[model samples]
Target chain A: MNRRSLVTIVSVSALTLTGCGQAGQGDVDNGDGPAEITMWTHSAGNPGELEVYEQIIADFNASQDDYQVVTEAFPQGAYNDAIVAAAAANDLPCLLDMDGPIVPNWAWAGYVQPLGLDPAITDSLLPTAVGIYQDEVYSAGYWDAALAIFARQSVLDDNGIRIPTVDEPWSLDEFDEALSTLQDAGYDTPLDIGAEDAGEWWSYAYSPMLQSAGGDLIDRDTMLTAEGALNGPEAVDFFTWFAGAFEQGWASDSGTIGNEEFNSDEVALSYTGVWNAMDSLDAVGDDLLILPPPDFGTGPAIGGGSWQWGISSTCSSPDGARAYLEFSFADEYITEFADNQVVIPATEGAAEASEHFSSDGDLRPFVELSQRFAVLRPETPAYPVISSTFEKAAKDIMNGADVGSTLDGAVAEIDTNIESNDGYGF
Target chain B: MTTDSLTERVVLRRRKVWSYTAMSALAVIFLFPLVFMVVSSLKPDSQILADIGSPQAFLPVGDISLDNYFGVFDRVPFGRFLFNSVLITVLTVGFGLIVNSMAGFALSRMRWRGRSLVLSLVIATLIVPFETVAVPMVYWVSKLPTLVMEGGMVKYDFGWLNSYHVQIVPFIANAFAIFLFTQYFSTIPKSLDEAARIDGANWFTIYRRIVAPLAGPAFATVAILTFLPAWNQYLWPLMVVQQESLRPVMVGMQYFFQLNTAWGEVMAYTSLITLPILIVFLSFQRAFVSSVAASGVKG
Candidate 1:
């Protein structure tokens, strides 16, 4: 061959190799022929979880002949961004594991399809697990978690303090006294509420404080009634006192500290979710103790749904997707998952299967606390606006801004957003 | 008179010492974060929190291991992610230089119709943020059906955000790159191209034989800028690639950080990701410094 022919041959050969490389490894079996269904889930870095999922997929493939599910995992942070882009590109997967907050958002944006759950399937889930928006069940939960307190048992014992139990939950005053004692013991900060970072602390620590003080960020009945309450005396009093703990050197000034900080014994207490208990225990090992969230009369505790699995709107095989969901929530699978993974289950069977809860510590406290005081965050499409508003107010408070004014501003911002988003009331 | 001369020499020496001190201080300030990142990655998670206020806490003193490095591999598909990143960066830089240089040469040297207008249009596109065009671009890419394989017609739905093409293709012929090349190519003597053409050489042959060989400094500039962005790209990659297997190091590192909140592991993974770039920079430090200096002089 001439030099030009050689060049052409080489280029064509290179192009052919590139094409072969692009053909991903997975045989599609969509009954009619071989079809590949791409599945995306938010479980990227957890090796243990990924392993289980791989097993599940293997089992699924073995049991089925119609379709092959090619699972792709992404971390929680990138999951939402990927979903939005995927939706825009019309390349959404056959199934997606999403957070509860995103379900309503995607549904409102008309990117999600209703599962149309049969009565048998719907009956198995917790009433609250049915994440409904606009009178449509957009998604269903596979796991549930509640805002609870995780404390270093060794630190509490060293300070001669008795940790609160589920039934005899510490009152707000008592909780403050315990924190003060720990602080006075020369531990620079007694609590790692993670106020600096806009995460669970807003829901677990600040929201509960507001609830205990007879103030709600959003009234459950009206959803609009709490604009005044956000900047009210009760709310301000709790925030100022909360800020005082930092001023008194009882809480770290760094707001970005997370549960891991507490788990590593950097702080004595962390107001985090029950779901973090296993991970925290893994970090600290045997020195950890679970406590009920502080109580203030009959007030609600900030709670929200955990992880949920849903079939994608663009899924090619709905039957295959439905079967997977059904199998995932089945008694045996939920039991095995909860037992092995240390996750809180969303179904009654899974909850009952907790007789086998093997964290070697009393797991009943978390279950009971979740049952009693757990109040779901507003499931409106406007919840992200609320979360951002809360985050801004929390940041302002942490930065020494006047709590009342900051919260008032946040409330106003949320109100404006709600009004602009067609004023969908709860 | 001799005593006075000796005293003057002493004064000059003192001034030199003062200047050296000032330069050292600036170097330390610039190097602090990088040094700290390296040290912190070696330390245990607990020590990171415990010694937050102490300089000693920055160093990995006790119980240091290669655990964090291993952790990165175990927690995420680090190897595959690295491979994907290498593939994307290599393709982007390699293809980018060829396409941009050709266009740059044409626009700057060749007398083509609407050359100035084309250059302006290319430059104008740079003003628009990628995010603003992302949704529309995704829509257009999804609608493109020609990319399908011929045999099965397995529609190559450009699922642009989820593949290598999205990350590398749109950015291959960057306006900045074209402009940089054009500026640098303009500096080259037109006589070289003219001489080559006088010998019966075609435009392609002239470009190959005369223009490209003389455009080394410009090519280096384009390669450096293009390669760095391709390597460090986060938002675009995060937006595009959902599959863990397809993600680059930045996206993989994010998952590793979140899943394993251990400071040591985080540091290790960060060090691993950053070490390659650091090594590359150090190896080509002279070229980088000279290129910047040359670019500054030209500007």
Candidate 2:
């Protein structure tokens, strides 16, 4: 080819390639009759979950003509980073789902705005399902996930252990005795506390034990510093018992993240989430008992919140986004989501209609636990740092670090991060 | 035979056996993970997890089927992801060859002023990690103008986010690729360029006819190197492309990693994604190895 012809071909190819990236199919305010608003979700691989959202969007679109919602789904693992990058580029969508715990950081970072839904809808929902930061509701979820002690009723009966209830959960001492009994009955590990999985699981699964022992992640009263609450004596006591479980050969951080060990009958109890309840029930039949988490000292506690919906700060049509958000709270959709995803529905009416999470259903115990035992993570922008610091300290403790000094170090790190960001807007 | 000869023969035989044994063991050690991934991909999630503690994990034992592979497709747009990855990798490597080789030619054969300094600066950038400048690059690219088809007329848009060009463009002119090309071209005799120049040839003609044709190993080396990183990109695409249809295979791996992870589906997805790169490497094994050894660039 001649040089000039080659240059022309190359320039044309480059221009064509550049033109291939049409703007994303979202609303551009051209003074149109009906605006098209973009929505983002983190349900890329979850067809069952994404189907529910798509139906809701379709119904919402048909119900009104003022705005038509266009939805995009990203993989759950990559969703937050995409949101952050889009926020940096000022290209955020009109609406998105925020993991309930991270709502504060996003709201504080000005990525999301207060949802401002009606009180009738908000008050009828489970408190744990509401995403509150700084005295204002920023997000709300369709359902909440609760943690439980998954045990086989036949194994408990074979080992002559009492079945614990929500009102009379096993105390720390009784739980210890049950573990010893299960161990004596030839189970190598009596419990799988999911220490094998790192990241937020460390805080979500184990931090509640500290709370049950009369300690908290941070001082909710001030939402500043982890000095007294995190490293207090009760907290240390909880960590000591936590580490002792591994040392005493009753539990170890070597098992898989799910209820695999329990389903395989390798362990007697699985400290896991409601997501695994259906699988364990299938594996063990009617013998599976989704028991409440054992109380350490003060009371039984479980981590609250799941993914919740919110409008972004840069949304062009806040009224349309809020309309979709409010419309999504319908009990029919909530029950559909809860049924499809096997989670505890947020509203009582939804729970009543949900086959799996109704008052007398197979998973009713999870609903009760979520209602009574779920404790929201510290509602401060400093929670991301606090969660990671707590995970590191908890891992170190399980791996044989000195409990007091390790927690003190975590406190130092959390306090440093909090102070660095001016207590993260306390 | 004499006693000394017999003993020496025995000693040499034993040494050969030991060498073979050690090499066989090393081969198995290196091959275990790939074998495990392929074998586990055929099994159900429960069986895969159950066999992890036993030798059965590396073997296709117990209940095995193509269910996970089917599950992978149901979960993700595997074919779309694979196509996106191959297209991006090919374009990046193809355009990269032209751009970097030309840059290499100017730095190596041409006697332009400040060539050494420019080459030095390009090599210096090899130490600056892509992660350190990724956020800044995103911010800059978001502001750069791009031609977008808007209502039947192409117009300029401010951001490059969520586009295929955003993934392909930033990665085309690589520092390591330029350095490899320059080093390889420097080894080729400059007499070829001089002879081509004497034959009524301009610099582009000399570069096209002489240096580029002679730097086959360098091009091969650059192509393989660029293809690997572009194919395996995770973080950059995650930051830029939010649309699922535009996502590559590496990001598709995250689709199978929900709360209740599908281990079998992940392995299946990985195996499917890995097949293309594996096939590419195998088809060009000789060229890839020779190019890497000649250019001193790892594949």
Candidate 3:
């Protein structure tokens, strides 16, 4: 062929391929073996969770004739990056699971579509477990995890410390006294707040404390900035005490990540989620006491939200994806997920039926904690940015940075980011 | 003469002793993490946590078992990930040595127009971090065409997503590899190439039989360097390859990093993945060290 003709042909083919790649995602129902519905999850290593997911997928596929659901499980640490990359390629799966706080950002970025879940399912879930932005439900989870102060009843009794309950959690003064009393009782570091945990964990594990101090990541009234809510008096109060925990040697930032410090008797108390409850119970037996988080001024609070399900914006068979979600949220599956993964089931019925969190169950208090004290992270499209910014500020405060200036700097950064993105559509 | 010679010998012996002591300490410091990982892999998580901040962490003295190894296999298909990593690394290194070495020969030994500018451009890419261009690269690769066998007929597929080639191809033509080869090949005597040409040999023949044989250290250096990155590839494979069957071992490390990380399993997986790299480095220790020393590059 002539050189010019060959060039023209190649260019045309290239453009054709580009267009086809974008259009190809929409061509799933071309009689290609039951309109394949691809689902992506972050349960690659958790055999318990992955088993439940596989069961759901198998049951859903067998229950259907028009659509077949397939799943791809990525490791939790790498799941977010994979989703972002796939969205860029227009190759996102029909069914995608994302962490709850990320729902708004992904929704605003056109990665996920707002769900139209039946209100029966939406109302059945813990309020914090349903991800909503601008009055639109974007995602819902099968389970929600709540954090608690894990203590041993025997130790508390021996140390002459009051056993705090869900109704009457330790106030700020009581908690401080308990830490001091434990420290004097020969436990060098009395609390394991998991300060060494990094990134989104800083926000997920600590922001509820900020809320309990009457501060928040952002002003939810406007959802435009973190000005007063973050750098205000209440936030400073929370952060000062947070830093003081480390400064006073009541907690150590160098300890292990999970309940190990508590399990090994290196620490008297552990600030951990329900995921660690089973391990602590295994070690401490009936002495394990899952106490509610300390109430600073407003009420006790624990960071709420966990991984949730959402449909990708570019899904070819979104209805089928929704069908799978709806099918997967049945009480039996939810209870099984709760029992196996040791997370609080999102629905009350499931919680009631759960082997781990039902009436008289070992970890029953977590259900009350999730119901009463669960505080959702700021739900705006600016959340991803807000989340990291809060993590940095909280980490700095924990490391003894000046609370006021650190919080102010964080507010400015968050405000600038929101403004830079036009308030992240508020 | 006897007194002076005896004093000098004594001084040399003391110096040898001091240097050996210092080197041994440094070696122990470096090997501490590896020992801890292997030892921790055999113990339960609780014991691993308890042994922290103590010398016992380095010793497998209590509860040494292969449970974590069994857990590693139960959690992930270690064999599949190992095969994928080996296949990708071998193919990448095998192809890389040929393609990059030739480019280096042409750039360094042959007379070509714009050769200097091309070499500068290739090296310039070294400054651009892979992360900065990862999204764009993902887009382009998704639009690229590939051939697929559909019912015994070769059909053109649009995207390279989820396939093995996506992991191997984009990484083969490495900028660092090319730069290493060009600099290494440049150090060889041009007289060898001229002699080969005098025998009426073509440029390809000279590159093959004359300069390439002399650039043994260069080939070894490039092979080792290419193998490391290929074996340790994480982000690219995670982005493009979605199938569990096609994932590399580095990405499999994430499997153990859940809300409550499986500490023992993490140590086990690291110890397992680390074996091949240790083997590769130890097998070519002398050649690798000599090449790096000659090239003045730190591995």
Candidate 4:
């Protein structure tokens, strides 16, 4: 061909290819036209979870024509680092999944948007879940799991010990007796307390112990005065008992043990979240039994409804984001999502779907615990600092340091952090 | 030999034995962590914490398994992450060497007005931390128009704010690379350039044929340093690349640990990510050593 004809043909081909590519790209961004929306999530969720989410997006696209959501997952450990960089770059995502403690920190920094719930959707949500951040709803959570103790029923039964039932939960004395019995029966690890793991074990395990002993990290009415709440005699006694268990070889020195240890019958008992039950039982094959968190006469163990979702302040489509949140709260979606994810629902109607709990006997304890004694973590800006102090003190006490003095020192550090940050009250 | 001479030889032998002992101890101290990582990668997750500080604990008390290695791929996108790291490191080193060398050659050899001023400005940028410029640079990149295509369509979406370009391009012409190249280039004999010019060669031809070839040792030095920082980069790439598909190995490793929380998988992934870089260094140690020695002699 002549040079002129060749050039013209090449140009036509290029134009057609570009047009086709544009059309394909447009299909990704809501089928209406080309648009972009960014999403950020913590890395803990399985990548497999995205398959379900993609299907949801496809269904949403089929139903309507607007903006499309492009999801991005960040490592949980480096999420803060990513957020800081994104803020500096002015390229933050439209939506983000933040940890419960980090929500206030991000909100106060004006890095997240305060989500005003649709009145229709808000009416269905549990009041406690909706008003977590402040008067204005900052985020919505779909699935939640409580931190609870998982025990080996066969081991207890073989030893002629009756385990706790829903009507008659084990008292602190009864719990200790069980641990002592398991140890005397020659089990190397009778209890798997996570004192050695970083702040996580204590945040999930010991903090509840403190609450069950009738103490809190901070008083809701007067947040600065953690002196009585966190460092009280009840807290000291609880730590002292926990340390004694470690010293007696009822628990291992390593605070971080695998869930398989409990499931594999290597350890008789372990403290962990309800989400671990399915995997744990699968490994051990049904000799497992779930129990209410051991009480200390003050109340049941204090942990519940722990995951949260928030919108990034940089979101270009807040309305579309809210619609997604509303859809997550819908009854059918919530029931399916919660059942598949193995978590408690955050909304009222979704919670009533617990009638299906009879299908899995192992899930009954979690449902019962959620109903009777689901206490939320103290949602405050000082929570991270308080959690760190508690963890440090717990570690020191576990290493055979004086429990009373350690509690006092941790309370002092927490109070100082709170006072310095002017994060005194709710 | 006299009795005193014999006694002195015995003392020297003892001293030699003591020195050998100390060196062996130092070697163990330096190599233990790596040994532990390899051994742990072969262990079950249940055995990791129990065997942490004890080598005996890692001995094959049970059948060894490749579960951890399989877990790394199953739980995280190891293959994609490996590709991303390779792409970023190769592009960064390849482009970095060329751009910095040209700028360095110009500054050192070419006599232009305000040459010192330009060199000084480049040197000054080395002191300013990249963190301070990150936000402004992202904004500037975001505002750049998408590259246009045929029929007035914007084919090349800049998505520069969260793309490979943002991670690799901002760093391609690094200040330190330029400074190193300039310092090394200045030491090259002006006679080479003069000879090339006398042979009727242009400036571009002189650079490619005469100058760059003569500065092989300097280029090797730049490549070693530049390749390392690019390979080990975590924060900047993490900031720019939002999609997991685009994440480099370091970010991928972080995600792997978060999702699995199994130390065995962590060790496996860590070993996988670091092994290639370690092999590269070991393979090129002689050249790397010579480059350093040459730079030192020149300076």
Candidate 5:
């Protein structure tokens, strides 16, 4: 090789080494002066949700110079796993958002610290918006999502079905009659009960129906077992009805979990979240009717909780993280989040400020439904195991397995997992 | 023409036509998915679902626009992600070829103690799944020393949780690549190495001048093999790299799968990422095919 070429190679190698050597230095936290507190969110592609968070971060950054909160967003599907990996590496950020039900598990695992905020800030928020575990607040959410029965008034009127109101929801017999009438009127499947969804939705959406039927995910009094709670007589009856829906062709697990089927006139009703209300409103206009879930034996119920923010236990600057968390709770930001994400605001003031969630708005019914009937899932660290077990058992029952045996198997699995984890700190 | 000659000619013609027809049908079947993806990318979500039951799904006939492509760009940092994937993939492929080939050369050609044991151990690692070792690997990488420039001064730090090197360095020394290289190198005659050494060439010289040049198929096979896993990495990158700018195309796929999935945008993003890989494979089609046919390596 020529001398000039060799010199060129050495120089280029040196420069490349220097560039890589200077690429990434961990941002240190000295507990003083513009601490770069990092935050993570599960909102990578949801532009409407992410835009509100970005504005909040920008405002908080510009408000003061003591701390600068920078955020990273991950897609929701991978967010929990990412957090767990980061925690394993001991590389977790100062602040992060978690699903409501997971806050307990994370707290019990020492991934998150107890969020210490003023009562004035938290007292105004809805109970479901506050993630409390072991009687200590671990996270708080700006918005809460509610489940409702999405229907078209025209379809109900054509089928001679009475329009159910929040004060007096359809009784168990009336609900069955409505489903029968809708099916007899030519709707292929009268209801889309989100049977197609798996994982957490099984416990979140259908367990609420079980609660209304006088059975619970676990005995909340002890928080240690699922034997009697999950496989009791009422629970068996609820599962029987759940399976009969599929057998009788009132609901099917074949369709996509969206408002498309209901909007396209393939189903007369949809049991879905507030996230679908915007599309339903756009498609059905004034004919849309957001009714409460049907009343079983106990009362009408729906699942509660959504994404919430928390401070990591390893955060060096706890006060700075608290400042950002506190700043994010303002009514205006909450209203903006609700307006953008089409969810219920956490506070009445924020609800009043939201365009779609206000008193006279078309989606206002979701707020009342969330207020009256939303039930948080089992708050124990064993909740994840319980959830997956219930999902499997429910799916089996829906597909023709004997309800009694399925429920017994689910209870056995839950009991075994809880015992294996030593009751998961119950 | 004689009657027998005419019959034989006609029979050959009919056989050739039948073969061509079969080939065309197989080609269409293979191309169906690609055609569906490209066509679906131009349509809306509702129309995409609605057309699935009909022949219109395979045709670009309804509610077609560039809206989904635009939505993809708006939703993700497409350029940044693609750049990261290209940078990481190229570096891994380049460094992997050199490292694995040298290791293969030593194992196959060099006479040393514990050589057989070392090759066996290297092959043993192939059975250990990546997911099994991923957690420990993450922990070790987070504690490994790293050089970084801070405040215009060079310094040392630990933890490689979110950088380009974190994604590239862990994947470069692949066991399967080394095994393929060693098997390929063992097939070459040792006489060439002896001849090169008689001319006063050293081990490195023999490796560079004699062995590497004649192992083109192995090199091509290793390059393509390394390029794919490096490009399509999802879980490891999702676990180690938190920065969006450093994410790969596979990890970017999760961005489109939120509660209400944007099906069209997903097809568009997939179509975008698949095009580059398709081009690379097509460019190296001959060598790749020959190498696979010889080595019997299945990806």
Candidate 6:
């Protein structure tokens, strides 16, 4: 090689090496200039929810000189993997949002830390909205979603099936009778149970049915085994009826994932979440009814919780992140999210001011349903595996496999996984 | 006409009809998805779901409009994502062809002590998936040094995160591309190199003049193959590229998958992004076919 070329290469390498500095959330927060606080959200495609967040960020940044919160949005479907990858690179943002049921797993994995907020702030929020892992509040959200049986009053009156209320939801036999009556009344599929959807929707939608049947995902007292709770007699009863619904032609496992069948007058009843309520109301108008789910021996139950915000353990400006979150929980912002996303506001004050979820509002039934029947998913780090296993077993039962054996297999899988992870730090 | 001749013509006509009929059926089998995607893109979500179980899914019948195509822009910055994808894809393919071909030339024409071992190592890397190394690559790239312009001043920055180069750099010099070039270049006789050497041309000149021009089919094949994965990149960019401006088109697909997915918008976005690839494939159809046949026949 030539001497001139060698000298030039050496000089460039030295200059590049000299440029190396530690990469993190900008500069250290040492009472210097406003520290850059990075925040992430799984709200990229959700314009209604994301707009509220962006407004809160803009207001917060303008109100403070000690901190500047910069936000990035990711699609909900791919957000979890992005956070995991960022954590692996030791590059997690200062603040990020996660689905509510996943909080315990992320907490146990050391991906997030407690918010260190006062109890007074959280006490006013909905019980199901806060994510408490190991007695510390790791995350919280502005709203929680509730599920209901959407039906038309005219269809029920025509079929001679009584309308179900939150206080007087249908019993197991009554629900069966109603489905049969609707099917006989010329509805091809009487119910849209959303069985065609994949992944977390399975456990979220069906586990509540099991809970109402007197079965739990795990014993909440010890939070360890799925043995008796998952495969016991109560769970068996629920699975049998679940399978029978398809065989008796009351429901079909073949429909679009959302409110299509119900809106098209093909199904007389739709068991869906609040997000689908607007479309059903538009389709059925004044005849639309939002009825509670059936009570199978126990009271009615619906899945609780939605996306919640939290702080990462590796955050360089933890205080700044906490400040942003605290500033964002005002009642007006909460109401804005509720009105925009068509969800139940997490606080009573927010609900009172909300357009759809308020008193004398069109969608107030969801609030009553959430308060009366909402049940949070099992809070354990083993929930990830448990949820997946339950989905597979439930799907197998729906497809005509033996219900007892499927539940037994699911119990064994969950128990073995918990034992392998040492009870997931119990 | 004689009876035998007339019978022979009848058989020929029947054979021709059967051939065209079979070809049309196969074409429909392949083209059905593209047709459905385009037709569905023109319908509302309710209409799209309603037509799904019938032949109406393949037709733009009732309630057809360009609303979804326009809605895609409101949801996503389609132009920005397209530009990002094009920039990343073009840089990766252009750099990949140059670097891999040079490596192929060195391994094929030049004498070296561990040439075969290096070629074997490059081929072995083809078996290892990119997902396995993604985390380590993200960590290393974050620590890599780069120059950035801030407020009209050139400053040294430490991380490659939230940058375009990170998306472009890590994907260049693919192992499959390198192995392909090596195999393709080996088929070019070394006698060209020897003759160029006797004529006072350097190895690089010999590669540029004699070898590379002859490997046009291989280059086109590599360009097409590399162009695909680079354009369709999702996970790596999702991991490393934090800024929305640097994200590619595949990542934009996730934007339509909210709680209640915008099915019409998804189809519209897909149609827009798939247009470039279909154009690339059509434009290079012959070279792609020739390169695949050439590689397979040689093997």
Candidate 2 residue lDDT tens string, A290-343: 999999999999999889999888888889988988899999999999999999
Q: Which of the two candidates, 1 or 5, achieves a greater DockQ against the reference?
A: 5
Candidate with top TM-score is 2
Model 5, span A262-379: residue lDDT tens: 8888899999999888888888899999999999899999999888989999888789999998998999999999998899999999999889999987799999999999999988
Model 6, residue pairs in steric clash: none
Evaluation by lDDT, superior candidate among 4 and 5: 5
Give me the runs in candidate 2 sitting further than 4 Å from their true place.
Answer: A1-9, A24-26, A30-33, B1-17
Q: Write the per-residue lDDT of candidate 4 for residues A1-426, one digit (tens) a residue.
A: 344764575465344323322111111344457355566677432554555456565665565556666666777777777776677656677777766666666776677888766767765654334435555677666656666678766788988777887668888888888888887887788877655557555775678777888888887676565788877888877888878878888887664544766766667888776667777777666677777778886877746535466777867677777766665566766666566667766565675675434335457667667767776667676777887788888888888999888888888888888888786435
**What is the C-alpha lDDT profile of model 1 across A1-426, one tens digit per residue?**
344874675466345423432332122454585366667778777766677678777777777766666788888777787788778777778777767766777777776778776758767775556677777776786666666778877788989888887667888788888988987887678887766655634654567667777776775566554476677777887778767877777776574455667766667888776656777877777677777777765554656566677767777676777776665566666656666556666666677766534333346556666667766667677777777677668767766888878888888888888777766644
**TM-score versus the correct structure, for each prediction:** 0.88, 0.97, 0.95, 0.79, 0.96, 0.94
What does TM-score give for chain A of every model? 0.84, 0.98, 0.93, 0.84, 0.94, 0.94
Task: By lDDT, rank the candidates, best first.
Answer: 2, 5, 3, 6, 4, 1
- Model 1 lDDT vs. the true structure? 0.71
Ranking by DockQ: 2, 5, 1, 6, 3, 4
Top-scoring candidate (lDDT): 2
Model 4 regions more than 4 Å off = A1-37, A43-45, A118-131, A158-162, A222-227, A236-257, A264-266, A347-360, A397-426, B1-75, B99-159, B173-215, B258-268, B293-299
> Worst 10-residue stretch by lDDT in candidate 3 chain A?
A18-27
Docking class of 5: medium
Measured against the native two-chain assembly using Cα atoms, what DockQ does each of the candidate structures obtain, in the order listed?
0.43, 0.73, 0.35, 0.24, 0.54, 0.35
User: For candidate 4 chain B, which ten residues in a row score worst on lDDT?
Assistant: B141-150
Local accuracy of candidate 3 as per-residue lDDT tens digits, A1-426: 344764575465434323322223332674647888888899999999999998888998899787888788999999999989988998888888989999999999999998888889988899988999889999999999888999989999998899888889999999999999999999999999888888888888888888999999999999998999999999988889998989999988898888888987889999998999888888899888999999999999998888999998888777888888899989999999999899999888998898889887888999999999998998898988888888888788877788999999999999999899997786
Error of 6 at B56 (Å): 1.7
TM-score of 2: 0.97
Each candidate: what lDDT?
0.71, 0.89, 0.87, 0.72, 0.88, 0.87
Model 5 over residues B1-299: C-alpha lDDT tens digits? 99999999999999999999999999999999999999999999998878887889899997899999999999999998998899889878977887899899999999999999999999999999999988888888888777666766767777777777788778888898898899999999999999988999999878887899898888888999889989999999999888887788889999998878899999999999999999998888988899877777767
